[model samples]
Target: MPPVLDEFQGLSAFDAIMRHGNLGAGAEHLGISKSTLSRRISHLEYQLGQPLLHRQANRLIPTEAGTLFHQYCQQMLSLGERSQMALDELREEVSGDLSISVHPHFLRGWFNRLLTEFIEEYPGIRLTLTSNLQPPTREDDQVMLWLWEGPTRDSGLRDEVLGHQRQHLYAHPDYLRQHGHPQHPGELASHDWVNLIDRHHPDLVLHHPEQGEYRVSLPPSRFTVDNVVVHADHITHGAGIGLLPDHHVRTRSVAHPGQFEACLPEWQGPSIPVSLHYPFGHPPRKLGALLDRIRRHVPKDWGQP
Candidate 1:
Protein backbone atom coordinates (compact mmCIF):
# COMPACT_ATOMS: atom_id res chain seq x y z
CA MET A 1 0.00 0.00 0.00
CA PRO A 2 1.05 3.55 -0.69
CA PRO A 3 2.13 5.37 2.50
CA VAL A 4 -0.48 8.15 2.84
CA LEU A 5 -3.50 6.03 1.89
CA ASP A 6 -2.27 3.15 4.04
CA GLU A 7 -1.75 5.46 7.02
CA PHE A 8 -5.20 7.00 6.53
CA GLN A 9 -6.89 3.63 6.30
CA GLY A 10 -5.25 2.46 9.50
CA LEU A 11 -6.16 5.68 11.30
CA SER A 12 -9.79 5.84 10.11
CA ALA A 13 -10.57 2.24 10.94
CA PHE A 14 -8.87 2.60 14.29
CA ASP A 15 -10.83 5.79 14.95
CA ALA A 16 -14.12 4.18 14.01
CA ILE A 17 -13.56 1.17 16.24
CA MET A 18 -12.54 3.33 19.22
CA ARG A 19 -15.48 5.67 18.80
CA HIS A 20 -17.99 2.84 18.67
CA GLY A 21 -17.17 -0.05 20.96
CA ASN A 22 -19.07 -2.80 19.13
CA LEU A 23 -18.62 -3.82 15.46
CA GLY A 24 -22.29 -2.94 14.81
CA ALA A 25 -21.94 0.66 15.92
CA GLY A 26 -18.66 1.05 14.09
CA ALA A 27 -20.22 -0.39 10.90
CA GLU A 28 -23.24 1.93 11.28
CA HIS A 29 -20.90 4.90 11.60
CA LEU A 30 -19.08 3.89 8.37
CA GLY A 31 -22.40 3.19 6.55
CA ILE A 32 -21.63 -0.54 6.55
CA SER A 33 -23.12 -3.44 8.47
CA LYS A 34 -21.60 -5.47 11.30
CA SER A 35 -20.56 -8.31 9.00
CA THR A 36 -18.80 -5.97 6.55
CA LEU A 37 -17.03 -4.31 9.46
CA SER A 38 -16.05 -7.77 10.64
CA ARG A 39 -14.74 -8.66 7.16
CA ARG A 40 -12.74 -5.45 6.93
CA ILE A 41 -11.30 -6.04 10.39
CA SER A 42 -10.59 -9.66 9.42
CA HIS A 43 -8.83 -8.51 6.27
CA LEU A 44 -6.88 -5.92 8.27
CA GLU A 45 -5.93 -8.65 10.71
CA TYR A 46 -4.96 -10.91 7.79
CA GLN A 47 -2.78 -8.15 6.33
CA LEU A 48 -1.17 -7.33 9.65
CA GLY A 49 -1.63 -10.95 10.69
CA GLN A 50 -2.73 -10.08 14.24
CA PRO A 51 -5.95 -9.75 16.19
CA LEU A 52 -6.70 -6.03 16.82
CA LEU A 53 -9.76 -6.70 18.95
CA HIS A 54 -10.44 -9.33 21.59
CA ARG A 55 -13.50 -11.61 21.41
CA GLN A 56 -15.85 -10.49 24.17
CA ALA A 57 -19.52 -10.65 25.23
CA ASN A 58 -21.52 -8.50 22.75
CA ARG A 59 -18.68 -5.94 22.62
CA LEU A 60 -15.14 -5.67 21.28
CA ILE A 61 -12.13 -4.84 23.42
CA PRO A 62 -8.95 -3.47 21.85
CA THR A 63 -5.87 -5.63 22.18
CA GLU A 64 -2.42 -4.08 22.81
CA ALA A 65 -1.91 -3.43 19.08
CA GLY A 66 -5.36 -1.85 18.89
CA THR A 67 -4.54 0.41 21.84
CA LEU A 68 -1.37 1.77 20.24
CA PHE A 69 -3.17 2.15 16.89
CA HIS A 70 -5.98 4.09 18.62
CA GLN A 71 -3.52 6.60 20.15
CA TYR A 72 -1.82 7.18 16.79
CA CYS A 73 -5.21 7.56 15.13
CA GLN A 74 -6.22 10.15 17.72
CA GLN A 75 -3.03 12.14 17.09
CA MET A 76 -3.52 11.96 13.31
CA LEU A 77 -7.12 13.11 13.57
CA SER A 78 -6.00 15.99 15.80
CA LEU A 79 -3.48 16.99 13.14
CA GLY A 80 -6.24 17.07 10.50
CA GLU A 81 -8.57 19.11 12.71
CA ARG A 82 -5.68 21.40 13.60
CA SER A 83 -4.88 22.00 9.93
CA GLN A 84 -8.46 22.96 9.08
CA MET A 85 -8.76 25.19 12.13
CA ALA A 86 -5.36 26.77 11.48
CA LEU A 87 -6.41 27.97 8.02
CA ASP A 88 -9.50 29.57 9.53
CA GLU A 89 -7.36 31.39 12.14
CA LEU A 90 -5.30 33.02 9.39
CA ARG A 91 -8.46 34.64 8.04
CA GLU A 92 -8.57 36.68 11.33
CA GLU A 93 -11.11 34.14 12.54
CA VAL A 94 -9.11 31.96 14.89
CA SER A 95 -9.46 28.16 15.06
CA GLY A 96 -7.30 24.99 15.55
CA ASP A 97 -5.64 22.79 18.11
CA LEU A 98 -2.96 24.91 19.81
CA SER A 99 -0.62 22.20 20.93
CA ILE A 100 1.95 23.73 23.27
CA SER A 101 4.71 22.68 25.65
CA VAL A 102 5.28 25.19 28.46
CA HIS A 103 7.32 24.94 31.66
CA PRO A 104 5.38 24.75 34.94
CA HIS A 105 6.65 28.21 36.02
CA PHE A 106 5.49 30.07 32.86
CA LEU A 107 1.81 29.11 33.30
CA ARG A 108 0.97 32.13 35.48
CA GLY A 109 -1.27 35.22 35.14
CA TRP A 110 -1.68 36.32 31.48
CA PHE A 111 -0.24 33.06 30.16
CA ASN A 112 -3.01 31.24 32.03
CA ARG A 113 -5.64 33.80 31.05
CA LEU A 114 -4.55 33.88 27.41
CA LEU A 115 -5.15 30.15 27.22
CA THR A 116 -8.64 30.63 28.64
CA GLU A 117 -9.55 33.46 26.25
CA PHE A 118 -7.89 31.89 23.21
CA ILE A 119 -9.98 28.76 23.62
CA GLU A 120 -13.22 30.65 24.28
CA GLU A 121 -13.01 33.09 21.35
CA TYR A 122 -11.70 30.51 18.92
CA PRO A 123 -13.86 27.66 20.07
CA GLY A 124 -12.70 25.59 17.12
CA ILE A 125 -9.14 25.65 18.50
CA ARG A 126 -8.63 22.66 20.74
CA LEU A 127 -5.74 22.82 23.21
CA THR A 128 -3.29 20.08 24.20
CA LEU A 129 -0.96 21.71 26.69
CA THR A 130 2.06 19.56 27.59
CA SER A 131 4.68 20.29 30.23
CA ASN A 132 8.17 20.88 28.85
CA LEU A 133 11.15 20.09 31.07
CA GLN A 134 13.81 21.26 28.62
CA PRO A 135 13.88 22.61 25.07
CA PRO A 136 11.39 21.44 22.48
CA THR A 137 12.37 18.55 20.17
CA ARG A 138 10.01 19.19 17.25
CA GLU A 139 10.28 22.12 14.86
CA ASP A 140 6.46 22.07 14.82
CA ASP A 141 6.38 23.25 18.46
CA GLN A 142 5.20 26.63 17.07
CA VAL A 143 6.08 28.82 20.09
CA MET A 144 8.04 27.80 23.16
CA LEU A 145 8.38 29.99 26.28
CA TRP A 146 11.43 29.60 28.50
CA LEU A 147 13.28 31.66 31.16
CA TRP A 148 17.04 31.75 31.76
CA GLU A 149 19.72 34.27 32.63
CA GLY A 150 22.01 35.53 29.83
CA PRO A 151 22.64 34.40 26.24
CA THR A 152 21.94 30.86 25.03
CA ARG A 153 25.21 30.26 23.21
CA ASP A 154 25.84 26.71 21.94
CA SER A 155 22.27 25.79 22.94
CA GLY A 156 21.82 25.00 19.21
CA LEU A 157 18.38 26.64 19.36
CA ARG A 158 17.07 29.62 17.39
CA ASP A 159 14.94 32.02 19.46
CA GLU A 160 14.18 35.68 20.18
CA VAL A 161 14.41 37.45 23.53
CA LEU A 162 10.89 38.49 24.51
CA GLY A 163 11.57 40.04 27.94
CA HIS A 164 14.09 40.21 30.77
CA GLN A 165 13.15 39.08 34.29
CA ARG A 166 14.94 39.97 37.55
CA GLN A 167 15.02 37.62 40.51
CA HIS A 168 14.92 39.21 44.01
CA LEU A 169 14.04 38.45 47.58
CA TYR A 170 10.50 39.09 48.80
CA ALA A 171 8.70 38.77 52.13
CA HIS A 172 5.17 39.62 53.15
CA PRO A 173 4.79 42.89 55.06
CA ASP A 174 3.22 40.81 57.80
CA TYR A 175 6.28 38.56 57.89
CA LEU A 176 8.61 41.55 57.79
CA ARG A 177 6.46 43.19 60.45
CA GLN A 178 7.07 40.27 62.79
CA HIS A 179 10.65 39.53 61.69
CA GLY A 180 12.90 42.49 60.88
CA HIS A 181 14.01 42.61 57.25
CA PRO A 182 17.59 41.42 56.66
CA GLN A 183 20.19 44.04 55.82
CA HIS A 184 22.47 41.73 53.80
CA PRO A 185 22.65 38.43 51.92
CA GLY A 186 24.72 37.17 54.87
CA GLU A 187 21.78 37.91 57.15
CA LEU A 188 19.62 35.54 55.00
CA ALA A 189 20.64 32.88 57.52
CA SER A 190 19.04 34.51 60.59
CA HIS A 191 15.38 34.02 59.60
CA ASP A 192 13.06 31.06 59.09
CA TRP A 193 14.32 30.69 55.52
CA VAL A 194 12.50 28.85 52.75
CA ASN A 195 14.00 27.81 49.43
CA LEU A 196 13.14 26.51 45.99
CA ILE A 197 15.04 23.31 45.26
CA ASP A 198 16.12 22.64 41.71
CA ARG A 199 14.74 19.09 41.58
CA HIS A 200 17.36 18.17 38.98
CA HIS A 201 19.67 18.51 42.04
CA PRO A 202 18.30 18.08 45.57
CA ASP A 203 21.48 17.92 47.65
CA LEU A 204 21.23 21.72 48.25
CA VAL A 205 23.64 22.82 45.56
CA LEU A 206 23.19 26.36 44.19
CA HIS A 207 24.48 28.12 41.11
CA HIS A 208 24.76 31.89 40.72
CA PRO A 209 25.33 32.27 37.00
CA GLU A 210 25.86 36.00 37.55
CA GLN A 211 28.79 35.51 39.92
CA GLY A 212 30.06 32.41 38.12
CA GLU A 213 30.00 30.65 41.47
CA TYR A 214 28.41 27.78 43.28
CA ARG A 215 27.05 27.86 46.86
CA VAL A 216 26.72 24.25 47.80
CA SER A 217 24.84 23.26 51.03
CA LEU A 218 22.75 26.40 50.78
CA PRO A 219 18.87 26.84 50.67
CA PRO A 220 18.41 26.01 54.33
CA SER A 221 14.94 24.53 54.18
CA ARG A 222 12.71 24.90 57.12
CA PHE A 223 10.63 24.52 53.96
CA THR A 224 11.92 23.70 50.46
CA VAL A 225 9.72 22.93 47.47
CA ASP A 226 10.53 21.71 43.96
CA ASN A 227 8.13 23.98 42.03
CA VAL A 228 8.64 27.73 41.93
CA VAL A 229 4.94 28.55 42.01
CA VAL A 230 4.37 26.49 45.13
CA HIS A 231 7.36 28.10 46.82
CA ALA A 232 5.98 31.54 45.89
CA ASP A 233 2.62 30.58 47.36
CA HIS A 234 4.20 29.52 50.63
CA ILE A 235 6.00 32.87 50.81
CA THR A 236 2.80 34.72 50.03
CA HIS A 237 1.08 32.96 52.90
CA GLY A 238 4.00 33.84 55.23
CA ALA A 239 5.23 30.28 55.36
CA GLY A 240 8.77 31.69 55.50
CA ILE A 241 10.76 34.43 53.77
CA GLY A 242 12.40 33.29 50.53
CA LEU A 243 13.84 34.55 47.24
CA LEU A 244 11.55 35.11 44.22
CA PRO A 245 11.45 36.96 40.93
CA ASP A 246 10.21 40.58 41.12
CA HIS A 247 7.29 40.19 38.69
CA HIS A 248 5.82 37.04 40.25
CA VAL A 249 5.24 38.57 43.70
CA ARG A 250 2.94 41.28 42.27
CA THR A 251 -0.33 39.48 42.85
CA ARG A 252 -0.18 40.20 46.58
CA SER A 253 2.46 42.89 47.11
CA VAL A 254 2.22 46.58 46.22
CA ALA A 255 5.47 48.06 44.88
CA HIS A 256 6.34 50.18 47.87
CA PRO A 257 9.07 51.10 50.38
CA GLY A 258 8.48 48.54 53.13
CA GLN A 259 6.59 45.61 51.61
CA PHE A 260 8.49 42.71 50.09
CA GLU A 261 11.71 44.70 49.87
CA ALA A 262 14.76 43.16 48.25
CA CYS A 263 17.49 42.73 50.88
CA LEU A 264 20.40 42.51 48.43
CA PRO A 265 19.03 43.81 45.15
CA GLU A 266 22.58 44.53 43.95
CA TRP A 267 23.48 40.87 44.33
CA GLN A 268 20.89 39.75 41.71
CA GLY A 269 21.76 39.20 38.08
CA PRO A 270 21.33 41.75 35.30
CA SER A 271 17.86 40.62 34.23
CA ILE A 272 17.33 37.03 33.05
CA PRO A 273 16.18 36.46 29.47
CA VAL A 274 12.59 35.36 28.97
CA SER A 275 12.39 34.20 25.38
CA LEU A 276 10.28 32.65 22.61
CA HIS A 277 11.80 29.95 20.39
CA TYR A 278 10.18 28.76 17.19
CA PRO A 279 11.16 27.44 13.79
CA PHE A 280 12.49 30.13 11.48
CA GLY A 281 10.12 32.00 9.12
CA HIS A 282 6.33 31.96 9.27
CA PRO A 283 5.10 29.70 12.07
CA PRO A 284 2.20 27.33 11.51
CA ARG A 285 -1.16 29.14 11.64
CA LYS A 286 -2.23 28.09 15.15
CA LEU A 287 1.23 28.65 16.64
CA GLY A 288 1.75 31.99 14.93
CA ALA A 289 -1.54 33.27 16.31
CA LEU A 290 -0.65 32.01 19.81
CA LEU A 291 2.82 33.55 19.71
CA ASP A 292 1.43 36.96 18.79
CA ARG A 293 -1.21 36.69 21.48
CA ILE A 294 1.42 35.79 24.10
CA ARG A 295 3.71 38.76 23.39
CA ARG A 296 0.74 41.11 23.46
CA HIS A 297 -0.57 39.69 26.73
CA VAL A 298 2.42 38.77 28.92
CA PRO A 299 4.03 41.22 31.33
CA LYS A 300 7.55 42.56 30.83
CA ASP A 301 9.28 40.74 33.73
CA TRP A 302 7.05 37.90 34.92
CA GLY A 303 8.60 34.61 36.06
CA GLN A 304 10.16 32.13 38.59
CA PRO A 305 7.76 32.90 41.39
Candidate 2:
Protein backbone atom coordinates (compact mmCIF):
# COMPACT_ATOMS: atom_id res chain seq x y z
CA MET A 1 0.00 0.00 0.00
CA PRO A 2 1.05 3.61 -0.55
CA PRO A 3 2.75 5.19 2.47
CA VAL A 4 0.11 7.93 2.92
CA LEU A 5 -2.70 5.41 2.53
CA ASP A 6 -1.11 3.09 5.11
CA GLU A 7 -0.47 5.88 7.62
CA PHE A 8 -3.65 7.94 6.98
CA GLN A 9 -5.67 6.40 9.84
CA GLY A 10 -2.79 6.75 12.34
CA LEU A 11 -2.19 10.30 11.21
CA SER A 12 -5.87 11.12 11.53
CA ALA A 13 -6.06 9.61 15.00
CA PHE A 14 -2.95 11.52 16.11
CA ASP A 15 -4.38 14.76 14.70
CA ALA A 16 -7.69 14.20 16.54
CA ILE A 17 -5.86 13.52 19.82
CA MET A 18 -3.74 16.61 19.40
CA ARG A 19 -6.80 18.70 18.50
CA HIS A 20 -8.80 17.56 21.50
CA GLY A 21 -5.70 17.57 23.81
CA ASN A 22 -6.58 14.12 25.28
CA LEU A 23 -7.03 10.49 24.19
CA GLY A 24 -10.61 10.09 25.48
CA ALA A 25 -11.96 13.23 23.79
CA GLY A 26 -10.04 12.43 20.60
CA ALA A 27 -11.48 8.89 20.54
CA GLU A 28 -14.97 10.32 20.97
CA HIS A 29 -14.41 12.87 18.21
CA LEU A 30 -13.19 10.15 15.84
CA GLY A 31 -16.02 7.80 16.88
CA ILE A 32 -13.57 5.12 17.93
CA SER A 33 -12.89 3.26 21.19
CA LYS A 34 -10.12 4.79 23.32
CA SER A 35 -8.21 1.47 23.14
CA THR A 36 -8.37 1.58 19.35
CA LEU A 37 -7.02 5.15 19.31
CA SER A 38 -4.21 4.17 21.73
CA ARG A 39 -3.24 1.20 19.54
CA ARG A 40 -3.17 3.42 16.46
CA ILE A 41 -0.97 5.98 18.23
CA SER A 42 1.32 3.18 19.45
CA HIS A 43 1.59 1.78 15.90
CA LEU A 44 2.41 5.25 14.64
CA GLU A 45 5.09 5.68 17.33
CA TYR A 46 6.58 2.25 16.52
CA GLN A 47 6.77 3.27 12.84
CA LEU A 48 8.47 6.56 13.72
CA GLY A 49 10.77 4.86 16.27
CA GLN A 50 10.03 7.48 18.94
CA PRO A 51 7.35 8.40 21.49
CA LEU A 52 5.33 11.35 20.10
CA LEU A 53 3.21 12.06 23.17
CA HIS A 54 3.68 11.88 26.98
CA ARG A 55 0.69 10.85 29.08
CA GLN A 56 0.57 13.46 31.90
CA ALA A 57 -2.25 12.95 34.40
CA ASN A 58 -5.58 12.90 32.45
CA ARG A 59 -4.14 14.74 29.40
CA LEU A 60 -1.78 13.81 26.57
CA ILE A 61 1.11 16.24 26.10
CA PRO A 62 3.13 16.13 22.90
CA THR A 63 6.87 15.45 23.37
CA GLU A 64 9.43 17.51 21.34
CA ALA A 65 9.19 15.02 18.43
CA GLY A 66 5.41 14.81 18.88
CA THR A 67 5.16 18.61 18.71
CA LEU A 68 7.20 18.60 15.48
CA PHE A 69 5.09 15.73 14.06
CA HIS A 70 1.91 17.51 15.04
CA GLN A 71 3.01 20.66 13.18
CA TYR A 72 3.78 18.58 10.06
CA CYS A 73 0.41 16.77 10.32
CA GLN A 74 -1.41 20.13 10.60
CA GLN A 75 0.39 21.36 7.48
CA MET A 76 -0.49 18.14 5.63
CA LEU A 77 -4.16 18.36 6.58
CA SER A 78 -4.34 22.04 5.68
CA LEU A 79 -2.73 21.42 2.31
CA GLY A 80 -5.15 18.57 1.59
CA GLU A 81 -8.17 20.71 2.43
CA ARG A 82 -6.84 23.65 0.40
CA SER A 83 -6.22 21.38 -2.59
CA GLN A 84 -9.76 20.05 -2.40
CA MET A 85 -11.20 23.54 -2.16
CA ALA A 86 -9.12 24.67 -5.13
CA LEU A 87 -10.28 21.71 -7.24
CA ASP A 88 -13.92 22.40 -6.27
CA GLU A 89 -13.55 26.04 -7.31
CA LEU A 90 -12.00 24.98 -10.60
CA ARG A 91 -14.86 22.54 -11.18
CA GLU A 92 -17.31 25.37 -10.68
CA GLU A 93 -15.43 27.59 -13.14
CA VAL A 94 -14.93 24.98 -15.88
CA SER A 95 -17.55 24.15 -18.50
CA GLY A 96 -19.69 21.07 -17.88
CA ASP A 97 -22.68 19.28 -19.44
CA LEU A 98 -25.98 19.11 -17.53
CA SER A 99 -28.83 16.85 -18.61
CA ILE A 100 -32.36 17.62 -17.46
CA SER A 101 -35.51 15.59 -18.05
CA VAL A 102 -38.77 17.55 -18.10
CA HIS A 103 -42.31 17.35 -19.44
CA PRO A 104 -42.83 18.92 -22.88
CA HIS A 105 -45.64 21.14 -21.59
CA PHE A 106 -43.16 22.83 -19.22
CA LEU A 107 -40.95 23.79 -22.15
CA ARG A 108 -43.27 26.73 -22.76
CA GLY A 109 -44.61 29.64 -20.71
CA TRP A 110 -42.76 30.81 -17.56
CA PHE A 111 -40.65 27.66 -17.37
CA ASN A 112 -39.24 28.29 -20.83
CA ARG A 113 -38.48 31.85 -19.85
CA LEU A 114 -36.69 30.73 -16.69
CA LEU A 115 -34.71 28.11 -18.64
CA THR A 116 -33.62 30.70 -21.14
CA GLU A 117 -32.43 32.89 -18.31
CA PHE A 118 -30.52 29.99 -16.77
CA ILE A 119 -28.72 29.35 -20.03
CA GLU A 120 -27.84 33.00 -20.34
CA GLU A 121 -26.61 33.17 -16.76
CA TYR A 122 -24.32 30.17 -17.05
CA PRO A 123 -22.77 30.10 -20.51
CA GLY A 124 -20.19 27.60 -19.29
CA ILE A 125 -22.88 24.98 -18.62
CA ARG A 126 -24.03 23.06 -21.68
CA LEU A 127 -27.61 22.00 -20.95
CA THR A 128 -29.31 18.96 -22.49
CA LEU A 129 -33.10 18.91 -22.18
CA THR A 130 -35.16 15.72 -22.60
CA SER A 131 -38.95 15.74 -22.73
CA ASN A 132 -40.84 12.66 -21.52
CA LEU A 133 -44.22 11.90 -19.96
CA GLN A 134 -42.62 9.89 -17.18
CA PRO A 135 -39.69 10.77 -14.93
CA PRO A 136 -36.51 9.68 -16.64
CA THR A 137 -34.34 7.03 -15.02
CA ARG A 138 -31.91 9.35 -13.24
CA GLU A 139 -28.23 8.93 -14.03
CA ASP A 140 -25.36 9.60 -11.61
CA ASP A 141 -25.54 13.39 -11.97
CA GLN A 142 -28.62 14.16 -14.05
CA VAL A 143 -31.55 16.23 -12.72
CA MET A 144 -35.22 15.35 -13.22
CA LEU A 145 -38.26 17.59 -13.01
CA TRP A 146 -41.51 15.83 -12.10
CA LEU A 147 -45.04 17.18 -12.46
CA TRP A 148 -46.96 15.30 -9.82
CA GLU A 149 -50.22 15.61 -7.85
CA GLY A 150 -48.74 15.50 -4.32
CA PRO A 151 -45.55 14.95 -2.36
CA THR A 152 -43.18 12.34 -3.81
CA ARG A 153 -42.63 9.32 -1.55
CA ASP A 154 -39.35 7.94 -2.92
CA SER A 155 -36.75 7.62 -0.17
CA GLY A 156 -33.86 6.85 -2.51
CA LEU A 157 -33.77 10.25 -4.16
CA ARG A 158 -33.87 13.88 -2.95
CA ASP A 159 -37.04 15.75 -3.95
CA GLU A 160 -37.68 19.49 -3.71
CA VAL A 161 -40.96 21.23 -4.45
CA LEU A 162 -40.47 23.79 -7.24
CA GLY A 163 -44.00 25.17 -7.23
CA HIS A 164 -47.68 24.34 -7.59
CA GLN A 165 -49.55 24.73 -10.88
CA ARG A 166 -53.33 25.01 -10.83
CA GLN A 167 -55.32 23.30 -13.57
CA HIS A 168 -58.57 24.97 -14.69
CA LEU A 169 -61.24 24.26 -17.30
CA TYR A 170 -61.05 26.46 -20.39
CA ALA A 171 -62.51 26.62 -23.90
CA HIS A 172 -62.59 28.89 -26.94
CA PRO A 173 -65.20 31.66 -26.94
CA ASP A 174 -66.67 30.31 -30.16
CA TYR A 175 -67.40 26.88 -28.63
CA LEU A 176 -68.88 28.36 -25.43
CA ARG A 177 -70.98 30.80 -27.51
CA GLN A 178 -72.34 27.97 -29.64
CA HIS A 179 -72.78 25.42 -26.80
CA GLY A 180 -73.74 28.12 -24.29
CA HIS A 181 -71.79 28.57 -21.06
CA PRO A 182 -72.28 25.99 -18.26
CA GLN A 183 -73.06 27.89 -15.06
CA HIS A 184 -72.22 24.96 -12.77
CA PRO A 185 -70.01 21.85 -12.69
CA GLY A 186 -73.09 19.54 -13.09
CA GLU A 187 -73.96 21.20 -16.43
CA LEU A 188 -70.45 20.43 -17.84
CA ALA A 189 -71.54 16.95 -18.92
CA SER A 190 -73.89 18.34 -21.59
CA HIS A 191 -71.03 20.29 -23.32
CA ASP A 192 -68.45 19.17 -25.87
CA TRP A 193 -65.19 18.45 -23.99
CA VAL A 194 -61.68 18.72 -25.48
CA ASN A 195 -59.74 16.69 -22.98
CA LEU A 196 -56.06 16.17 -22.30
CA ILE A 197 -56.30 12.43 -21.86
CA ASP A 198 -53.04 12.18 -19.94
CA ARG A 199 -54.17 14.47 -17.12
CA HIS A 200 -57.90 13.76 -17.03
CA HIS A 201 -59.85 10.70 -16.01
CA PRO A 202 -63.18 9.40 -17.39
CA ASP A 203 -64.76 11.40 -14.58
CA LEU A 204 -63.82 15.06 -14.06
CA VAL A 205 -63.55 16.34 -10.47
CA LEU A 206 -64.02 20.01 -9.66
CA HIS A 207 -63.64 21.84 -6.35
CA HIS A 208 -65.55 24.87 -5.10
CA PRO A 209 -64.63 27.08 -2.15
CA GLU A 210 -68.05 26.63 -0.50
CA GLN A 211 -69.77 23.83 -2.49
CA GLY A 212 -66.90 21.35 -1.71
CA GLU A 213 -66.19 18.64 -4.34
CA TYR A 214 -68.20 17.59 -7.39
CA ARG A 215 -67.53 14.78 -9.83
CA VAL A 216 -68.81 14.91 -13.44
CA SER A 217 -68.63 11.89 -15.74
CA LEU A 218 -67.25 13.09 -19.06
CA PRO A 219 -69.05 11.95 -22.22
CA PRO A 220 -67.18 10.26 -25.06
CA SER A 221 -65.28 13.09 -26.78
CA ARG A 222 -64.26 13.44 -30.42
CA PHE A 223 -61.06 15.25 -29.39
CA THR A 224 -58.59 13.92 -26.83
CA VAL A 225 -54.80 14.31 -26.88
CA ASP A 226 -52.05 13.35 -24.44
CA ASN A 227 -49.94 16.48 -24.81
CA VAL A 228 -50.98 19.57 -22.83
CA VAL A 229 -49.74 22.00 -25.55
CA VAL A 230 -51.83 20.18 -28.14
CA HIS A 231 -54.71 20.08 -25.70
CA ALA A 232 -54.38 23.85 -25.23
CA ASP A 233 -54.31 24.33 -29.00
CA HIS A 234 -57.46 22.25 -29.37
CA ILE A 235 -59.14 24.41 -26.73
CA THR A 236 -57.89 27.63 -28.40
CA HIS A 237 -59.38 26.58 -31.76
CA GLY A 238 -62.76 25.82 -30.16
CA ALA A 239 -62.51 22.00 -30.18
CA GLY A 240 -64.14 21.55 -26.74
CA ILE A 241 -63.74 22.44 -23.08
CA GLY A 242 -60.44 21.17 -21.60
CA LEU A 243 -58.35 21.47 -18.45
CA LEU A 244 -55.14 23.52 -18.64
CA PRO A 245 -52.62 24.89 -16.15
CA ASP A 246 -53.38 28.44 -15.11
CA HIS A 247 -50.08 29.78 -16.49
CA HIS A 248 -50.80 28.39 -19.95
CA VAL A 249 -54.29 29.85 -20.11
CA ARG A 250 -53.14 33.21 -18.76
CA THR A 251 -50.24 33.43 -21.21
CA ARG A 252 -52.51 32.42 -24.10
CA SER A 253 -55.11 34.99 -23.16
CA VAL A 254 -52.42 37.69 -23.12
CA ALA A 255 -50.99 36.72 -26.56
CA HIS A 256 -54.37 36.16 -28.21
CA PRO A 257 -57.08 38.39 -26.82
CA GLY A 258 -60.66 37.03 -26.77
CA GLN A 259 -59.41 33.67 -28.06
CA PHE A 260 -60.29 31.49 -25.03
CA GLU A 261 -62.43 31.77 -21.92
CA ALA A 262 -62.55 29.81 -18.66
CA CYS A 263 -65.40 27.35 -18.18
CA LEU A 264 -67.16 27.28 -14.76
CA PRO A 265 -64.83 29.98 -13.37
CA GLU A 266 -66.17 29.37 -9.87
CA TRP A 267 -64.77 25.81 -9.70
CA GLN A 268 -61.09 24.79 -9.70
CA GLY A 269 -59.33 21.70 -10.91
CA PRO A 270 -56.67 19.82 -8.92
CA SER A 271 -53.31 21.57 -8.53
CA ILE A 272 -50.31 19.83 -10.04
CA PRO A 273 -47.28 19.90 -7.72
CA VAL A 274 -44.01 20.48 -9.55
CA SER A 275 -40.86 19.04 -7.99
CA LEU A 276 -37.19 18.67 -8.93
CA HIS A 277 -35.49 15.39 -8.09
CA TYR A 278 -31.84 14.35 -7.94
CA PRO A 279 -29.71 11.57 -6.50
CA PHE A 280 -29.67 11.64 -2.69
CA GLY A 281 -26.22 13.11 -2.16
CA HIS A 282 -24.20 16.25 -2.56
CA PRO A 283 -24.10 17.03 -6.28
CA PRO A 284 -21.13 18.40 -8.17
CA ARG A 285 -20.56 22.13 -7.68
CA LYS A 286 -21.72 23.02 -11.21
CA LEU A 287 -24.92 21.03 -10.87
CA GLY A 288 -25.49 22.51 -7.40
CA ALA A 289 -25.24 26.00 -8.87
CA LEU A 290 -27.79 25.14 -11.55
CA LEU A 291 -30.19 23.66 -8.99
CA ASP A 292 -29.90 26.81 -6.87
CA ARG A 293 -30.73 28.94 -9.89
CA ILE A 294 -33.81 26.85 -10.63
CA ARG A 295 -35.06 27.11 -7.06
CA ARG A 296 -34.64 30.89 -7.12
CA HIS A 297 -36.45 31.34 -10.44
CA VAL A 298 -39.52 29.19 -9.79
CA PRO A 299 -42.54 31.36 -8.99
CA LYS A 300 -44.07 30.80 -5.54
CA ASP A 301 -47.57 30.90 -7.03
CA TRP A 302 -48.12 29.96 -10.66
CA GLY A 303 -51.53 31.70 -10.49
CA GLN A 304 -54.91 30.11 -9.60
CA PRO A 305 -56.98 28.23 -12.15
The TM-score of candidate 2 is 0.70
Q: What is the lDDT of candidate 1?
A: 0.63
Which residue runs does candidate 1 get wrong by more than 4 Å?
Answer: 1-93, 139-157, 199-219, 254-270, 301-305
Whole-model alpha-carbon lDDT for candidate 2: 0.76
The runs of at least 3 residues in candidate 2 whose Cα sits more than 4 Å from the true structure, single-residue gaps closed, are: 1-87, 139-155, 303-305
Q: Write the per-residue lDDT of candidate 2 for residues 5-117, one digit (tens) a residue.
A: 44477888899988998988999998899999999999999999999999889999999999999988888866666566656666466357777777677776766677687
Go through the candidates in order and give each one's C-alpha lDDT. 0.63, 0.76
Candidate 2 residue-wise lDDT at 249: 74
Error of 2 at 265 (Å): 0.9
Which pairs of residues clash in candidate 2, taking residues 3 or more apart in a chain or in different chains? none
How close to the true structure is residue 301 of candidate 2, measured as C-alpha lDDT? 57
